[model samples]
Target: MTDHVDVLIVGAGLSGIGAAYRLQTMCKGKTYTILESRSASGGTWDLFRYPGIRSDSDMYTLSYPFKPWTHGNAIADGEDIRRYIHETAHENKIDQHIRFGHRVTRASWSSEEALWTIEATNDERPVVITASFLFLCSGYYNYDAGFTPEFPGLEDFQGEVVHPQFWTDDVDYDDKEVVVIGSGATAITLIPSMADRTKHLTMLQRSPSYIISLPQDDPIASFLRKVLPLGLAHRLTRRKNAALAIGFYVFAQRFPRLASRLLIGAARKRLPDDLDPRHLTPDYNPWDQRLCIVPNSDLFRTIRHGKASIVTDHVAQFTKTGIDLESGDHLPADLVITATGLQVVAFGQIEMDVDGEKVDPHEKYVYKGMMFSGLPNFAWCVGYTNASWTLRADLTMQYVCRLINHMDANGYAFGMPDPTGAEGESAPLLNLQSGYIKRVAGMLPQQGSNSPWTIRQNWFLDSRDSRRADLDEAMVWTVRKPVAVAG
Candidate 1:
């Protein structure tokens, strides 16, 4: 069956749900539909069912700006986040507009008609939809599989090996010796949560990551909730948390050495006095990679109590019982967890084409980090790396709404970022050094050296620009240029 709408949103996750709400409130009478690939809502939050899965960033900024997170915990668990998204969608009647089990495979835009023909499959059957505007809220990661490196002798391992992305509750690990590989946020979270149930938990890493401990319950937030109105308290806490995160990021960038020393020093104070500092000291400077946050010093407390251990060494090979280290050391385990990283996929695995020409993301330049240069009526939400993801997602949706309204006011059918006169040096989309980002850098879009084209990682700057920026100067909206007739 064929469907049509004024706006078509991809993915029913956090960003998509938020986008629906914004469109409903801001652009009234604009019919829209949300195409969700999975059978349910809450894209990433619902996908991963691993133990101890929670947000590394604080919930104050991670949650939607309109919806105040009433939950007491600043660092909320995956279940709570899922529930929040579901509640928001249901309350706003956004869930009713969602078409679950529809995985969009390809989208072709017709410049003359000024519409996008989206093709997808629902329950192995073909489905098609057309829309005037396409808002891609689908996340950047590959949902099919997480990034797992090829390990030598992995096939010979007798114990169960698992990746957190595909984890299930039935895969029992109770009273088993667990060895978690990698030192990212996922590994750190899993270590503490599994430490109690396992015979012993060992966090095996090639190197250390910068880990910080913060209180789970913010005293200021708790007090504000008691005295002030709920909405005011939520906004205040969100601003405070956003400022603290931005301040730390700016400090780290400006004074890498000093920031590194202070961060390492703080981490050292949390661990046992007799423990060697090398395990906590990262070779790289602060902010080079995302910092690992453990709410209320839970990871350190577990280590100090001898429920878990951290080992830094290179893996030589995977044995039948465990892993063999290159430095003549071996770790025996009954279950191994590879918390390696994610596989980044731009545009949610959908192939995009304009006027029958396939769009190569790497070749195209990004416009304001959301819209692709020369791509009309298309925008995707990519969050900031330095701050909370929702902070940028919220701004992105607002900007898209403004653009749509601007087009309507001007009586235009198409809007595209045409960079003709202003051109300068271009750089990679993200400035991060994480394994997942580095792996897919070549396939991602590039940003220009100047404003409107450059991808801003700062929330303060992006939020300001998203609200008041003039679109006519940067974006071109008009009738499609007629195709020249062949001689």
Candidate 2:
């Protein structure tokens, strides 16, 4: 049986739920349904079951603007975030519109029909659905497995191996020495989280990344919540946090040397006397890649208390007992945790075709960081690389709502972004130097150097521009045809 709706939203995570809420509130009377591949909601939160799973960004900006985050902790745990999403869906009755365990595989758009035929699977059973518009809220990463680089002599390791993405309870770490590879957010988070329980924990990294310490709870937010109304407090706190985040990013980009010195100095102060400051310093400047945030200096505290340590060196090979370093240093471990990185996937790897022509995302230019050039009635929610994800996500959702309303008002069948005269050198859609992003840069869409086609990561600019955006500019729209009625 085939089901049809005005809009079909893919994924039921943070972005998906937010998208649904925006569509319902802004575009009233528009029928929409959410198709989630996972059995439950909470995309990243539900997928990752690591030891110290928490959000890198503050909750205020990470959460939806309409639904105020009531949690006192600015850095929220994965479970807390999962529950919050579930609550939001339930509260707004969005849960009823979600079909869980529905993995969307293919989407074909037909110009003649002015509709998209979606193919999905539920419990290995094929299912078909159609929608006038398609919104991909599925995140950028591969859900099936995280990226793990092949280590030499990995099979010779006697200890149990695990990736933080697929962490299981049965993998015992208590009283066992653990070695975690990679210097990314996951490695930083896991070091402190598993330190107390493990006999000893070592963060092994080939190169250092900028790390900063932040308070788990925001004092200003707490005070505002106590003195002002809930909604007002949330808005104020969200704005303040967003400003700080954006300001820091701007500062780093403009004055990289100053930013690097400050970051290294801060880390130097937090480091133990025995540990060298060089281990905390990165060759790259701040915001070149993402800076790791350690709540309340927990990772530093863990090191200072003799629970954990950091090792900056190249892994020569994995030995039977542990890992051998290129510098002739050996680190013994009972378990190895590969906190490597994520495997980025474009549009959830969903095969898309328009009029039987297979759509190659790489060949197209991104329109305003959401829609693709020449793609009709389609938008993908891509978050910011330098700031809180929800900041860009909210903007994209709002613009989508406005675009849909514009089409409905004009009696248009579909709207496509045309990049014929857009003048600019094409660049990678995501403006980040992160390893994961660089690895899959060619697989994603390209962004032009000019407006509409360019993806400016600035929230202030994007928010303002999105509001006053010309709907007709560089857009191709078709009038809705009259439906034939039998006399």
Candidate 3:
């Protein structure tokens, strides 16, 4: 027997939970179910269990707008974030609506019936579900495996090797000399946390990334939480953080040289006088790639105390004891961690089709950074690359709910993006030069050069447009013909 629902949400993670909450509360009488591929609800938080696995963005903005974060730590650990997700799911009674281990493999939309036939595998058993609307909240990155570049002589290395994405509890690294490859956020976070346990720690990278230090706890947020109501305090803090982040991003984009100097200066103040400034400096301009943040200058403190170090060099090969540098130097290590990055898996690798035609994401233009061109009754929750992810996520959920309500009032069976008014060149959905994004650029959707079609990574802009934009302005809303009841 095939299950039927009003709405089918594709993920049970942060975005999925938020989507469910909005659908249940605002869009009353709509029945929805979340299909989670994994056994757990916390998508990224549950998957990543590496040392020092914590959010780089502050929790104030990373958290849902509806749920005020009571935790004191702005930079929360993976476990805490996971717990928060679970708590939200439990409190909202969304857990009962979620079907775990149900990996959606294919979805076919029928215009005649105005419904989506979703096919999935639930514990190796076939499970078919039909829904009027499909909400994809599955995150952009692949959960099964992270991006690991094959290095020459890796097989010859006798020492233990690990990737941050697949880190397990059984692996031991106490008092071991650890060398972390890549200068991204993962490496930056792992360096400081693993330094205390390791005999010596080294962060080896081909090119440096911008590293900034932020306080783990926000004094203003802390005070606001104490003085005001939780909801009001959360709103105030969320606005403040959003404004600061937007201002910084704009400043960096406008004056790249000045922004780079200021960022480097900030790092220099925390580093030892003897430490080489080049290790913390990047060749690219600020915001060219996402910045790496370390709370309380933990990374700098570890480096300054001689407990950890940074090596700016390319790896020639993995030696038996450690990695051999292209600069004719060898770094000794007992464990080598490839904090390289993640693999991009678009839409959880689900095959989507409309009216018997397969949907090629690269060929379609993104509508409002949520809906896709020529696709009806489908929306995705893709967050910002420049700011906190949840900032855009919250807006996306609200916009989707608003859209659904508009459709219901207008008696529309489904709504799809009509690009008749959209003209001009198309760009990649994400404008980031990050390795993970670039690796899967060909498979991702494209965005147009105009409003409602272009994806602006700014949170304020997205929030305003999503809230105020007219659904009928760019969408081809349709209503199924009512079948006449026979006497």
Candidate 4:
């Protein structure tokens, strides 16, 4: 099947919906389509249904700025987030443009045609859609399944095992001994919430993660929400959080040792002294990997009250009885939750080729973390590594809208960040220490060491560059030129 649209958006998540909403509002006369792999909206929020799941950060920073989140808590739960995404889609009428059950398997660019050919499987039927532009809101995490550490005898265990991603309404852990594997944010988030409902909860981590504790609720933000209107409370929190976020980022970058001490102190307070440190403390910088967000950090309160316990031991294998640790210790459990991190996919593992020459994104320079050099009319959203991801996401959505308006007003089919010698050549995108950056290795391109896109992970720099930066500084935006009509 062949379909034509002005723009094709993939994913239907926060990024995809944000992109689609802007496109629909801006290109009112043009046709647009959104192809989501899942039948529902709310990409990650809908996908993750594990108990004790909620937003790691405050809702004020996590929510879309255009709309106010009226949820009672500063850090929202899955249902609220899912409802928020659904509500946003409804308010913007984005759901009407969305085509559910269409999974985009491949998106290839055509230089001759100056368009992207998106191949998707709709209800298992092959369909191809062509559009002047392709926007990826598919997110970085995989939806197929969450990763589970290889257990030697996982099948031997008679008890039911669970990965948070596949959590269902049927799996009941109430008043039963349960073990949650992994020390990351998911495990941290799960421990406190499940402990309340379970007879016993044990957090088993082969390795430890930096656990920063906060109260289960944000008292200040919560108080503001109770007193002020949701809109005013949101604005107040946004400004306060934005400033705090920027300040912390500056301190972390400028004074690494000092920042680490401050963060480590916080983590130490939450974790026990008897627990082994070798596996828990990360070898890298704090923000280099993600920092766990604990609202009121209910995890600490749960542990302190003796309702939950944390163990730092290398898991050996799964047995019929329970999980065996590297120390030859056995921990018995009726249910086990594998909350072990997530698999990161760069550009959702999509391949882009300009003409016959393959555009290896890993080898291409990233412009503004959205556009790739040598490729035109393509934009992707990669949010902040720290703080509420939506903070950067909101700004990015607005920026894309600006770019769309700039292109339409200027009369350009679509302009790409041409990193050729004509503009500014020899940019690289590799960081010496990033796991994702290292994974790409030789295939990854590097930006100038000083380029905002290179070292500018902070919200302030991004805010200035994306919002107020001179457009000329970045090699994005289109210079619209009339298309030559067919003879």
Candidate 5:
């Protein structure tokens, strides 16, 4: 059976839910349905079950603009975030429109019909759906598995090995010696979270990543909530946080050396005297990659209490008991955890075609950081790497709504960003130097150096420009023709 709607939204997580709410309220009477690959909502929050699974970004900015986050802790746990998304969907009655366990595999756009044909699977059975517009809210990373490098002699190790992505309940860590590999956010979070439970925990990394400490609760937000109305306080707090984040990013980019020094100095203060400061220092400057946030210096506190340690060395091989380092040192471990990284993918690895021609993302340019050039009625929701993901995602959602309303007001059948003479010197869509991003650099879309094609990561500029954007400047709009009746 085939289903059709005015709009087809992919994924039921944070961005997907937000997209639905915006569409229903702003574009009233528009028919839409959400197709989620997973059986549940809360995309990232529901999938990741590792210990210390909390958002690095503050909840105030990460939350939807329409909804006020009343949680006491600015840095929230995974379960709390999951509940928040669920509550939003329930309150807005968005849950009724979601089709769970439907994994979208292919989407084909037809300019003649001004529509899209979507192909998905529900439990190995074929399910087809059609829509006027397709919105991909699926995240960038591969959900099936995380990135883990091949370590030598892994089969020889008698102990159980685990990855944070697929952490299960049966895996025991209580009073067991554990060694977590990698130095990204996941590794840092695991080290502190598992320190107390494990007999001894050690973080083994080949290189260092910049880590910063932040308070769990925000005093300003608490005070504002007490004094002002909920809606006004939330707006003010959101703006204040956004401005502060942008200012720090600009300062770091302009003065990298000074920023690096300040970050290293702060880490040193929290770290134990015996621990080497080199372990906390990265070769690259701050903000080069996403900074790891440690709430209330939990990682440092755990290390200082002799519950955990850090090892900066290359792994030579794995033995029956533990791993041998290349620096002529062997560390004992009973359990091994690989918190390497995530496997980045474009548009949730969905195969996209326009008029039967396969769309190569690398050859295409991103229009306004959301839509693709020459692709009509399609938008992908991608967030900021330097700041909270919701900041930019909200802007994209609002802009899409505006485009839909504009098309309806006119007699336009569909609109697409014209690629002719618009492609200049292009760069990678994402501006991050992280390992995951670099791995798939040649697969994602390109961003030009000019407006509407360039992805400026500034929230202040994007928020203002989105509202006053000239929809017809680089877009090709098709006018709807009257259908003739046969005599």
Candidate 6:
């Protein structure tokens, strides 16, 4: 027997939950079931557990409009963020709709039946679910595993190798020498916290990242969160922070070299005298890959205090004793934590097909950076690539509600993106690229050649078009039924 639902949401991440919440509240009398691949909620927060794993963007803008975050630091730690997600699920009463450990492997559209056939497995037991609408909320982050480099002589390594995602409670670096790999946010976050316990910490990277320093705590943000109620505080903070982020994103995009140089200059001032600027510099501009945010230069302060060191060189190989650098040096480590980035898996690696034909998503244009081409009754909650994810995701959620209300008024069952089959149009709202965003750029929806749905990556535009704009024929995917027979 197959269970019937109005909407089948995949992956219980921020986006997935957001979609579910919107549908639950707005879609009167519609039944929706959310399938989470994992046994728990909190998607990325539930997945990654390495030391100091946290949000790079400020918490105010990173959180949803319906849900708010209260933390001393605007950039929250993983634990705090996780707590917020759990609380939101519980408070919103959305937990009952989610089935844990139910991984959706494949879904096919049955046009004849006007339903989606979703095949999912929980603990190796397969279950069939049917739904009228399919919302792919599974975020772009890899849920399967992380990328760990195959160093030479790995079998002979004496120390333990740890990954951030599967990190356990037992990884105590207390008085031990720890070496963390990768220059991404994970590594930068791990350094300070790990340094507090480890005798010494070493950050190993082949090339340096464009790292910027923000306050460990935002005074205004923290105060606002305390002074006002959650809803108002979150809204005000989101607007204020969004304006700042948009200004920075615009400046960086318009003046790439100048922005890069200014960031490089800021980084240079925080390093030791012996460090070479070029060795620690990057070939791409800031946010080209992703810029790392630090808590009041904690990583820099630790490096200056001699508790940690940043080594710039390629990893040649690994020995039984330690890691061998291309510079002909070996750094002995008691514990090696691989802060290596996650292996990105789009839509949880699920295959989508319509009546036995495979849907090559990359070839299709994203309608508004969420839904696919000509696939009505479906909406996705994918976020922006340039700025904070929730900035775009929150907007997408709001848009979904607006669309749902419009469809409900017209007595419609579905709404899909109109197919124009445009080229290079589906590319990201941002010109820059990251591993995950790059892979799915053309595969997602297109906004326009430029903002809201085009190249305008501004949160304000997303707010206006997605939330407040008129959805009159131009910006919405809508469907309605024919007039019924008169009495």
Better of 5 and 6 by lDDT: 5
Residue 450 in candidate 1, Cα distance off native in Å: 1.1
Selected candidate, larger TM-score, 1 vs 5: 5
lDDT tens string, model 2, 1-487? Answer: 6899999999999999999999999999999999999999999999999888999999999998998999989999999999999999999999999999999999999999999999999999999999999999998999998998989999999999999999987889999989999999999999888888899999999899999999999999999999999999999999999899999999999999999999988888887777887688898889989988999999888988989888999999999999999999999999999988999999899999998999998988888889988789999998998899999999999999999999999999998998352565788888888899999999998888888788887888888888898988789998999989999
lDDT (10s digit) by residue, model 4, range 254-292 = 887777778777766766666455644666676655667
Q: List the candidates' TM-scores in order.
A: 0.97, 0.98, 0.98, 0.88, 0.98, 0.90
- Native-referenced Cα lDDT, model 4: 0.74
Clashes in predicted model 5? 0
- State in Å the error of residue 339, model 4: 1.4
Report how far residue 345 has shifted in candidate 1, in Å. Answer: 0.7
Query: Which candidate wins on lDDT?
Result: 2
Better of 1 and 4 by lDDT: 1
By lDDT, rank the candidates, best first. Answer: 2, 5, 1, 3, 6, 4
Q: Which pairs of residues collide in model 1?
A: none
List where candidate 1 sits over 4 angstroms from the true fold.
419-422, 480-487
List where candidate 6 sits over 4 angstroms from the true fold: 225-230, 423-431, 435-455, 468-487
What lDDT does candidate 5 reach at residue 301? 91
Query: Per-residue alpha-carbon lDDT of model 6 for 181-236, expressed as tens digits?
Result: 88888888889877878888899887788889998777877787678887897788
State each model's C-alpha RMSD to the native.
Answer: 3.1, 1.1, 1.2, 3.5, 1.1, 3.0
lDDT of each: 0.90, 0.92, 0.89, 0.74, 0.91, 0.76
Model 5, 1-487: lDDT tens per residue?
6789999999999999999999999999999999999999999999999999999888999999899999999989999999999999999999999999999999999988899999999999989999999999998999999988889999999998998989987889999999999888899888888887899999999889988888899899999999999999999999988888888889999999999999888988887877787898888888889888888999889988899989999999999999999998998989999998999999889999999999888878899989988889999999998889999999999999989999999989999888652455888889988888999999998888898888887999999898889988799899988899999
Q: Tell me the deviation in Å of residue 255 in model 6.
A: 1.7
